[model samples]
Target: MSALLSLRSVSVNFGRGEKALRVVDGVSFDIDVGGTLGLVGESGSGKSVTSLAVLRLIPERLGWSTRGRIEFEGQNLLDLPADKMPEIRGRDIAMIFQEPMSSLNPVMTIGSQISEALFLHGWPNRAKRHARVVEMLRLVGIPDPEGRLGAYPHQFSGGMRQRVMIAMALACSPKLLIADEATTALDVTIQAQVLELMKKIRSDTGTAILMISHDLGVIADICDRVVVMYSGRVVEVADIRSLLQRPAHPYTRGLLESVPRKGQERERLYQVPGSVPMAGSVRQGCPFRARCSVAVDKCAVKMPPMFRFAEDQRAACWVSAEQSNAPVIEDLK
Candidate 1:
């Protein structure tokens, strides 16, 4: 099966030499047609950087650089000309950025901003573009779409602004959607609404989604597949159900264990001990070695290669990778 989007051992570094900080370290994953792949991790896990690299939004002139390939529909995005990117961006792949307040222009009306993508993507009919904008607003669950056409970013609530951002992203009905913490600002009700809207978009348009978020619940809510990132590296990748039921990587298990479960009681929430390594400090072994409870001396001495557990799931842990072939704690449980 072909992927709608693919990132192959993608590494992102800022600056050069000793000063260089590897923010995104050798990440690999893919979003198949109409599939939603969630990137879940703590802040600074390089999820955003990976997304930015895919969109070619990383500031190279400011010293950011990437190694490996980011492909969309088999085309290498890194090799595309700068002028060609704008076309692919809105028309083929759109992004709902992390920060609505910063991503949306305060000076532009929501309708115009939403309509602009349509127009730029070659929808020249004025009436048709306006109609599409209204439809998008309504699809995103905004009431009185016609009346709110002229409203500016400042006029809408944060949640409403997020909906507008979503509206703009979906205006072109692209093949892929990169949503970074997409519903963070929305109330639970609106969040559910937005998630449903995304699911509908996937079903109706077959748009693959790269959903980046910290919320496991949100990931479980909307994503079919999951990619667990830790300190700029992909520690695990699996189907959402299998991942929740049987996480192979210790970091992934730690994250899931830390989430507040319905029946689980605790005096203190489980915490992955220690902090993530500074991006500047190059580690020879697993990035999570410092915090992993199950980590062995090998974890500190040698970097674990990404070992495949299944066709769709892989993990970068020697013990877990080895355990996949043998009956152990996770399998016994």
Candidate 2:
């Protein structure tokens, strides 16, 4: 099957001069139609920026792709004319941000907001557009679509606002949806509901999803495949089951260990030692070298190429190929 979205060596850098930062570095992955790919990492791992770059939503003056290609549906989206990019964005690709409160307009009525896409895409008449808006709301499982139309974003709770965002994103039935921490702000119960709704949408509409989140549990529930990012690079990529069962990279392993699980009782949660290094402070060799308990002299001197574990699984770590020799430490100091 052809990939709905593919990023070949995509990189996004911001600013220039002494303070310049490379937020996303040489990352590459693909999402097939009707497939869900979860991007998992700590904050500042470049997941959000990478998604923004793919959507051509990176800030104009502050950021640009220093290199690589963003191909969507066999076309290089990066090569498209600027004016025409917006047409592709709303119709063929859509995004649900982390914060719906800030992402939605406070001044606009929810109906007007959802209808905007249909209007822009030329849904024919105002009556048709109104009907489309109500249909979208219903499709997203919102109650009382007729009454909710006049409501402002602030009138709805956080979960309701997020539902509006999802309804808007799917108004035109986009082929690929980029959900950047879509459920992060909601309560656990609501988060589960939203996630289930997304899964239902994907299955029913056959829309591909690039779901970005730091929550492994969420990913395990929804994603068919997973990509683990560390300091702007992909540390590991595999089938969801494979990754959860046997993560190869030390960073990936660290992430799994950090999460609480059923039947597992521990006083304190495990955390990867040291924080993600500041973008500009990154030096030569492996970006995770400083935090990796398994790092060796070679790990500090040379960056590892992505080594294949299976046809679909890969990890950028020298030790993964020789797990017996991989370091086994109780904790990092």
- What is the TM-score of each predicted model, taking all chains together? 0.94, 0.95
Q: What C-alpha lDDT do the candidate models reach, one value each?
A: 0.86, 0.87
lDDT of 1: 0.86
Q: Deviation in angstroms for 329 in model 2?
A: 29
Model 2, 1-333: lDDT tens digits are 889898888877777655667778778888998899999999999999889888788876654555588889889888988798889887999999999789999999999999998887768689989999999999888899999999999999999999999999999999999999999999999999999999999999999999999999999989999999988888888999889888888899999999898898899999988899865357578899899898888888877777777667788888776663433221111
* C-alpha lDDT of candidate 2 relative to the true structure: 0.87
Give the Å error, residue 138, model 1. Answer: 1.3
Question: 1-333 in candidate 1: lDDT tens per residue?
Answer: 678888887889999998789899877788888889999999888888899899898999999998888889899998888889988988888999877777899899999999999999999999999999999999888999999999999998877888899899999999889999998867888788788888888888788898999999999989999999888888888999889988889998999988987887789898888887865364688788888888899998887877667655778788887777722223200
| Candidate 2: stretches off by over 4 Å | 17-19, 324-333
Q: What is the total number of backbone clashes in candidate 1?
A: 0
| Backbone clash count, each prediction separately | 0, 0
